[model samples]
Target chain A: MASDDTPAIRLAGLRKRYGTGDAAVDALKGVDMTVHAGEVVGLIGPSGSGKTTLLKCLGAVIEPTGGRMELAGEAIYDAERGGWQVGDLRALRRDRIGFVFQAPYLIPFLDVTDNVALLPMLAGVANGAARKRALALLTALDVAHRAGAQVSQLSGGEQQRVAIARALANRAPVILADEPTAPLDSERALTVVRILNEMAVQYRTAIIVVTHDEKIIPTFRRIYHIRDGVTHEEAGEGRPV
Target chain B: MAGVYRGMVDDGQVLIDNSGADLWVVQQGTLGPYAEPSSIRDDVWRGIAGIHGVAETGNAAYLTMQIKQGGHEARVMVVGIEVDRPGRPGAPPYLTFGRPILQGHYEAIADEKTGLKLGERVRIRRHEYVVVGLTRRMVSSSGDPMIFVPLKDAQEIQFLKDNDALINERARTAANPAFNRPGVPGLLEAAQASATQARNVNAVLVRLAPDVDPDTVAGEIRRWKRLTAYTRAQMEDILVAKLIATSAKQIGMFLVILSVVTAAIVAFIIYTMTLAKVREIAVLKLIGAKNRTIAAMILQQALGLGLIGFLVGRVAAGLWGPAFPKYVLLVPGDALRGFAIVMAICALASLVAIRAALRIDPAEAIGG
Candidate 1:
């Protein structure tokens, strides 16, 4: 587990604007946020509320217009520099961040085990070791019996579990899950939230889940709500899954 | 197409290789009997034999004509060699059936490709000859199968005219006033007899002694005997570069066009396949997959498709090769070169797909 004082992710006065000259639109306005180790938080927002823009900035898929951002105790982006602190955002994303989409979106060609093993493989782990790590994660997620099955053979809930397994395959410091339970039933949705909370504590990783699912909303200890282009942090009910 | 050209080019070489001779002596100012008509006196081999470094010499007559058998007719190059002695330079290199021509006048050894059965009677200009033996791989520069007969019969067939033409020529000779002078005695009869008889052969095949240079002997033949002589390599050049140069060029143009079309097709297919996976590619990029990883995936697929195409093409060619009118020479060197070219083309074709995959924005994987 990480030391108590260190944060897994931090952002201060992050701003992003699209285009320029009279046509510019600010997607994120002075967004300030922080996520600590071994924590699971919720992010709820209305349509076009800069929720996706904030996630993109955090995932390193897009550069912020202005901001000071830190990940895993290291400064990554700053407004004064007007750019990223690191040279290769791709490497940072691969080594330090994980993501889960609304859809499971597992690679169809790869079997379940390879779907998880692929991250470590990309990180240059030997095939044997990568597969072993993938098997352990599958077992932890309770989908180990389907490890050798094709993605198409997996059910919706099973596929989501496999996706979570893949996100944790590299043991990244932070995970940004966008609507991780949008298609699940109430029972399955709570199960997914429970698994996410368990994974966060077990791996000492911070997880920020973006969702509109009312069924899984009360499971977070804290929630960040965004409107227009700004975010407001608040305490959650912290209901046990 | 290239195989057929190779076969035509090799036809001339096949002839030279079969003869096993070091030099070919023909009439002055000619490219030898195979490329042009060159009729030298039948006894020229005697003078060539007397040359230093010359081990042996044999007379060879090549006459390409249509021969009739039963109700079928086939064009064949009738080669007249010394049948009295076996294993001569002009003889068929090997016989697949029956015996060599023991009685020279009406017996022949025909290449198997001619479709002539043993003991089948084939009518030439004015004589009926029986096929006594069968050989293989003996063909003319134009890919016509060869029919090996005695040197005497080939000369007769090459020089003799039909009976009507012969009669007309005798009468024309007798009526010429210069020969029919009042007291010419037997001069008219002698002239007719001389005109009817043929005393020329096409060329002479020359074999040199060990440690002798073929070019040196060819130089001596050209300088002393006043005859055109060609070494093996020079003859090959005339046959390959001169005889089939135009056809080779045409085949080369066809191959270039074929390669372009194949590359275009491969590129389009790979590009389409890559485009079909746009969403998957976006997801991969979002997950931090390298650009090279996506590129390698498309490239490997293209190469695999090319390998399958090559295997199917090779099998089809092999199955239909013998059915072609000309021999199709499918050598291992050509097959290997073709495989390498296909792989190169496949790799090049995948570049477009790789570029498109690289351009996919990782942000697309997340909704706005």
Candidate 2:
């Protein structure tokens, strides 16, 4: 469960470095950001600006050099705790955080419903209940009619919608979207952003969208512009979809 | 190839089982009658029968040669058995059609594999014999079908020379000073007759009385009669362990090599299939799929492919087995063993792909 009183995602002094000594390179110098529950914020950056690194760090896919991260009201990573406070990062990611990639990246072997249901199944939910949850999300995303279809049979926009449903299937408090609408046209990209907003408000989740696509930039209530290894917050137009 | 070798081994066992003998008395100091040649005087059976523990004795001759039938030639093993009694040793255990040899000389009982029909005439050397009966599973150690003929005919066919060679031999004998001496009367003719006649058989099959130990009788024959006697167990060893040992070893090596090649092919296929799904695997990991889960997916795929392959191979072998020149015996035990081996190979082969999939970075799905 998420609430506006406690932010779903919070980071302070997050840092990441690659290699050592003479070949050492700092990917994320220091980052500070927060997004309350039921909000979708945009992250825009050029190449080599550390957006993907930050996303990886938040997704618990990579270890941070130094950071304090609290998700779903639990401090998962703190430098003073000598790294991660969570014992199992895989379970932590599975239960609390969801990710939507640049491409749909659905498991092609599974049909559309199963692709969404697999997350809950991996978390030990019963198969019937997991499929019921997946079907509910697919209905919310307006792709319920294709629940029995394979991933390859779906159109591009339909596949992306299914990916969104999959990310929201576990009822995770935090959803991280990395260029999720990059492959879509203007109308589809805006549609993807509108769906993200509706899903965030409906599920009470904090969403962060990192994209180079300018088509959906104005839809965010706020934006974070990252340069080199640092992030700067700015006020967005917050235009209506 | 291993199947054929197994069939050959089984063929040898069938012949031994059909003989229904407790002991095989071969020539002294020789491994014979099936894997090697042996020749003892035709009267050796009479001496063997007189032994205390011996219940009965029968003489048998075995020779392999091409027989012509209906303008076609097929190599077969000619087996000579005594036709004087119904239940003699070295007789075909059972007849599938017609009757056993009645008159003895020109009547032959042929294995159905020889393609000889009842009453068909086949030429064995200088004699054309009528096929009087047909038997099944009667084959030599080398997988050639067996044609049962009378002892006299088999011996003559095995030892008798052609007309020109016989005449040359008689003339040569008449010109010899040793046989044609002035004081000699019928000596040259006796010598010629002895030279031309075949008075030897391959071996003597001995049947022992009930509750009598074959080893004891065999030991007595070897000691007093000065003949090499093989008990049923020893004969089986001679057939399975010695007769076809080299061929079995060669076939075993071929099977090992084929298994390795099949493993390599399966490994390559699984690896290629894994590489094709790199993105999907990465996404699975990115979404918190456990290593065991992904590994199981790959393993299941490999095992499925192996199952399909095994079924297809079994069907193909069943379809083509009968067309081979030799017997291709497919045992249920062998099929079960083959299925287990295929699944084991497939499981082991998928390790490479499983390792590759495990090493894939979940970040690859998100991209830089």
Candidate 3:
């Protein structure tokens, strides 16, 4: 069980290698990071800097060659085991982590409410209860009016908001956003960042936003810059949105 | 004669020809080849007449022969009946033109399909007969037109050898030296006279008393007369089951091939539909949807398509069944069985698409 003082996510000496022998290429080398509850952090790097690889390792989509990772208060990966400690990585991902991608890839056949409620349903929640939870999150995200609309009928901004609502539907402790605001205008980009901040504080969730977008970089109070498979932490200007 | 024996009238009962007889008796194991002539000694008619339930009995001869008409040979079934009355047991059920064959020889009644007009002459077995009447739908089991001739003429056509063959047979017998001895003068003539006589009939047709059951009469004849008698139901079985067994097997093979083709087409369609949604599948997996959930969706879609196709096919078959040249029976039980097979095929066909959907990697949804 997680305690109040436990960090939402922690990583130390996380390392990943692509292959073995002479052809092997190390993607991550001795990276360390931590994000507490109720905080949102930024990860920015150039191409081939291992940002995506590290995010994948943190999300448990890929295994780290050597590392220690803690989610909430539970130990998920250990360097000695050389793998994840969770019995089922898929269930671990569904119950403990959320993801928002560059494009809002909502299921085309499902309506907005069902698109958001699907996560809870997969986690063994009843259909009606899942929909209620989805409606509540949609109301908080200000997209409740389009709850019954198809994903294709919504505007670009509306679709991204629905994706955010889906990410928060399961009340997961951590969310990894991969260039989520990349396709938005500056105003919409800042609006997405502000919503992320509000959601992080209200739900006590830890969020890591990975991006190369210069327009929204200043909104983060702390940013980690990666160069050559290594991360260096620095303080952002923390400009208000 | 075969067609008349098996035809269903408007009231759904088997049509009885002018033959007021209810049942037919033939030699054992000879019912299958009804058109081929078989001799029963001509005296069996007396034994059949003595049966307890028999009201009347008549002897008939059947032969399939080629008749010369307008420089062409037409295959026909020549039937022989005792024309003593207007509506005898072996006469055509109804006539459309001219009149029945009142004389016992040299007169004929032909089916309309034979193209024989009233008062026209046709040659059969070195004898010219005048067609006196025309009938409709009077055909043999193989759809050959029937030509009704008198009892004695039909017997000669069925049993008498050609002139040359008969002369050769008599010469061979005389050369044997067993019947040509000097003391046996009448023995040789007696043998020749017996050879020239035509005294056999193919079957005996019997009419039962009003209150007697045909099965009971058939049993009695079989027990006492040492011959085979067939009731109406038994005759129907012989015509439908035995005669058409090969055709039924051919149709069964065609149905199997059609089902296989339908399954392959369904599988291809479902596989293509799944491929179109590959991106959506990745997204679904990344959002933590289970494999079974995706599989069930594809299965349901396949079954829905099959249901629509089956309903349309059934309606089309029903609309066109009556117009077929032969009888096409579309029973409810066959339709239900077809429905079950369609659903099973759809379920099996969706497996290919389900397997493809399950193999989609969730990492593809989150590009690096």
TM-score of each: 0.87, 0.92, 0.68
Say which docking band candidate 2 falls in: medium
Least lDDT summed over 10 consecutive residues: which range in candidate 2 chain A?
A: A1-10
**Alpha-carbon local distance difference test for all models:** 0.90, 0.91, 0.82
Q: Report the lDDT of model 2 for residue A177.
A: 97
**Tens-digit lDDT string for candidate 1 (B235-334):** 8998888988888999989999999999999999999998888877887888779999889888998999899989998998899999988899988788
Which candidate has the highest TM-score of all?
Answer: 2
Docking class of 1: medium
Worst 10 residues of 1 chain B by lDDT: B1-10
* CAPRI grade of model 3: acceptable
lDDT of 2 by residue, A1-241 (tens): 5455888888999999999999988999889898998999999999999999999899998999997888966888898889999999889878888989888988887899999999999999999999999999999999999999999999999999999999998899899999999899999999999999999999998999999988889988899999998989998888888
Best by lDDT: 2
User: What's the lDDT for residue B118 in model 2?
Assistant: 97
Which candidate, 2 or 3, has the higher TM-score?
2
Which of the numbered candidates is closest to the native, going by highest DockQ? 2
Q: For residues B191-254, could you state the per-residue lDDT of candidate 3 as single tens digits?
A: 8878878898888888788888999999887787778888867765665565544555656677
Off by over 4 Å in 2: A1-3, A185-191, A235-241, B1-5, B68-72
Instruction: Extract clashing residue pairs from model 3.
Output: B19-B89
